[model samples]
Target: MSSGRMRYAPTSKLFIYSMSTLYVVSPPLEIFEGLKPELRQRIVTLPDFLRYPAGRIKGITRSLLAGRVALPRRILYYWFPKAYFDCLVQARPGDAILIYEACNVRVLRAIRPYLPERVPCYIYYCNPVGTTFRRPAEELQAIRALGYRLTSFDPCEAERYGMACTGQYFRYPEHQPDNIDSDCFFCGLPKDRAGTLQRLRTRLEAEGLTCDFVIPRTPAEKLTYPQYLDRLARTRCVIDISQKGQTGLTRRPLEALFYGKKLLTDNPEIARYDFYRPQNVFILGKDPEEQLRAFIESPLAEVPETVRAAYDVNEWIRHYLP
Candidate 1:
């Protein structure tokens, strides 16, 4: 959300105020439930607005052409749900628009014609490049050329790409988790981590821990957010395995912090975060098995609700919009 965005509302395009609203355009993920109700209204998922190919061949053709042929890409994207674009055209210059990094530059280019003048538009990366995204440097340059600012959740990635390092967050409902069906929980694409997750599960089970590790083969096979969170609510510990080269704070650690579940991750950078407590977080490689066992056995530590709320999407957007 630290990515600067261009937003326009119903009225005047004037100086930014403390209360300017934010509009987010992201990939297909329901991440706004944790935001204050009013903030949720401005969020939009891109996939829904984009026209779906009627059949498999068209889908494949579109996928094949969207990246190479600019004319076809714009022609395809220009056909996106009109109402969503209308919101942008009508938005005042003062509002802020956040376009998640997942939305490619082609999509950004397609929307350029409708963008309000000097409307702050941002490209925020929730995932690291080369890991989940293969966007080249030219793409960032093109994005900037179109007057959009770039930001990332991972500090290392931000530094590597010359982007603003915004903290990764979880948009989860604020409530104490009461269920406890498993000792550990994990759900994600294998992404070269299948063997690692399997071995880790074996070790945790050897430690007498019941692990609910869901290693889906693809994103489509992944569990829904509600299903994943439901599993998290029933677990005592949340597993945090970064994509092969990533060392960023993922949603797993944040989920652990907000839900009072112990964190079991390979990301040592988490130690630098304020909410990180050794008693509650067990670094996969750095911490000993004994420490991990203790962390698992000990009751989860308490994190203030206020601290959890600080990660809310509303608060995150406010930092950039304000």
Candidate 2:
């Protein structure tokens, strides 16, 4: 497990051989919309069962079953026979196969036996290990055994799993306004941190700061990706509360940099990154209220164009799939 700090660029041979590519991505297709046109055209996506009603039901059922039963590694083949068949029939020698988040464990297993020995296989894990709802440990090991090149968003987790770390990427917006409506913004599942977040909000409000803190209790309350970004663009600062055991940077900080907003995060390790600016980012810890107040009052600094470009989806794709 090398530190994710190491960069991966595509070799001349890889570009020459990767004329055809298969992408087995999870739902919410808009995330990959920023891919270069040529790369998008070269890649084919597998069926996302969550997009259809019957498939959604199967997904929910499988999730419930997975909570109570340890499913066999190959069960996904039976659950998603169409996807398994498609991967087997569509993949060719020298083709590139990119699997996002190890979400489709069975498909990976089923397709492994059929993948041409010369083909390049890569799996990117967006979530930290042990956090996934399915058999994460087993699935990761299976992916390793099958010779897939693994990548993770979390640098520490990448090292723990012995995988490459490709930090999170964001789609650079066509236009981002300088005007801001709120002093601070945050929206996410509570993940058992509801009380702490609520208290933080209360404290901020007591300081007379405008905070748009949202902890959606229902699915309808959740914002779409675009809606989330829109809200982000309207805020002066973004608050990031890392999940337990998470040391990797999430997309929030990168989003702040892209939109020119300040960041207040509990992830102290962010201070180690090259792009970290004390004037722009405040790590929450002792006397967080004081830190938050000062950070809000301070002028936002200009992040270098190179730093911003490094996290762009276009650059990320070039590194991962080049």
Candidate 3:
């Protein structure tokens, strides 16, 4: 008997050179799955050869060797460094290239000689200036010269560094609970600071707010993403105080706002963001004893519907993806 199904189908199609191949380099695997699972099915992960002592050439060589693995028609290499640009340049004309970080302008420039003349390079950046721009001034200048279009969380940071931003950085929306689980003060203590948290705990106890608080104790100690969300949900309020560095709203305030809890942060610029309000976030200085007392006694209710409506994640995703 004839195999009718196999006989009827053809595996190959006519050659079409005009097809599209979108490449995303060094992107988070979670986000990849979220964006388009079908697309990720066609992804080719770049190896971590850049971690080698000899830099790009060695890394590129390693990646080429590892490339015995099949490559997708629409290829994506996650977290490859600038050194990999040469390999990207050698890719098919219809192939797309994505750059995840703007920090490596120097590497981008180095590959200027090889960048496909018509390919578009996309940058998705999420760095506060103090961290990414801390290298020598000359290196910083080199990054600026490359002039990659950027996506960042804060416009002010991009302006401060003399870089133009294409759009705002997108993040997943905060999902807060309707009821408060515990009456407690939750603060993240600096691991490097010896006895600092102990002294602060002692002072809070003297003021009658007596709790050791949930703080990570070891370098290996880390909460899973869901556990972190749970932590935000359980606590009535979050104390956001950055003891060092340029204080912007770190992740804490965002988490607090989403959980519909009060936030006590030292950063004044937080007021400018859509999340902060007198009822929700309270700005405090070095000593928050009085303010902390008032809050612990009577916490604010759930965030208003109007405010919640404004912080939608869908809008953020549309803005970034579009």
Candidate 4:
């Protein structure tokens, strides 16, 4: 409810225009705190399912028809949520447009025409492209040809797709940190990082630093946002080791920034950011265990309010616009 993306109109043409009201269509996430209240209210969650389990069949059917039978938008549009309709209907040329998450593209395609004329759209990649987007090059090429602006936080992706390199965004809750019980903490779906996390945990423990690592095996094992934040509250630092070769700064560093905690990340790109502080961050592979231990014990360098403000979702929206 707090932060998902809004439904969108298609990216069919370019309009030399700017709007104070930005409509974002993204997969559900909880990190929308950076925007003002009015902007925050515009977010809409994607892949909205029916109230009952049986409705999923309808979604699957819709996807199938759109793919196989070439169902026309006039008929397929009914499958979307009313929120999607309202977003398109109420959107004016004065509003900014953004789309995220690969799954939501179908919805954008389904109701492309209802949107304002010649309003350019922005698609931001929040995760690594391969992990989140499975569509072929042709699909993306088609999207780009239609005048949508593609962007990502990953420099590699930006180079690969010719997308505008953009900054990542986050906002922490007002909840204060709990008394620190561990030296470091990490929680995420264990996609190939399980062994690496366990190894890091052991190494940290060997160095006399307690590590709280949560690598969920099943969907049920995944922690809700509140639960994860509670764990984060207890740690002096947060650990972020990306899948090998992932160089982009993920949310871990931002979490560390907002929570006033240190971070152990493997991202070499961290050094390139304005907030990078040797005292506050320990890069994996670059830092020996002894160095990491010292980093955990080091006094966290304070990030200025201005530096922190630059990473907000609001700033992310404003940065990529023409």
Tens-digit per-residue lDDT, 1-322, candidate 1: 4233534433332222234445566443556656664554444333334444476876676566554545432355445544465555555766777766544666566566667876787778877777544665766767778778888888887887778887777766555557689988999888778889988988888888898888887667788877888889898889999987787888888877767788888988888887878889898779997666778989766777788878766677665662
Predicted structure 3, TM vs. truth: 0.62
- Candidates 3 and 4: which is better by lDDT? 4
TM-score of each: 0.81, 0.80, 0.62, 0.82
Q: Rate the local accuracy (lDDT) of all candidates.
A: 0.70, 0.70, 0.50, 0.69
- Candidate 4 clashes: the total is 4
Model 4 Cα lDDT, one tens digit per residue, 1-322 = 3333333345321111123355556534566544576545544333333221246777677666543444554565456555454554466655656777433445445455555665566777778777765663555666676567788888877887788888677785678755888888999887778778888888889998887888888888889987888899789999988876578888888888988889888887899999999889888878676787777887888889999988876676566433
**Candidate 4, pairs of clashing residues:** 5-26, 5-44, 6-24, 6-44
Q: Which parts of model 2 are misplaced by more than 4 Å?
A: 1-18, 22-24, 50-78, 81-88, 103-107, 133-139, 177-179, 286-288
lDDT accuracy of residue 134 in candidate 1 = 62
Candidate 4 ranges with C-alpha deviation above 4 Å: 1-20, 27-29, 38-60, 67-74, 103-108, 320-322
Lowest summed lDDT window (length 10), candidate 1: 9-18
lDDT of 2 by residue, 1-31 (tens): 2221322222211112235454454523565
In candidate 4, position 272 carries an lDDT of 92
Cα lDDT, model 1, residue 182: 92
Model 3: per-residue Cα lDDT over 241-291, one tens digit each: 554444344556766655556776667777777655676676655335566
In candidate 1, residue 173 scores what lDDT? 56
Candidate 3 local lDDT, residue 256:
66
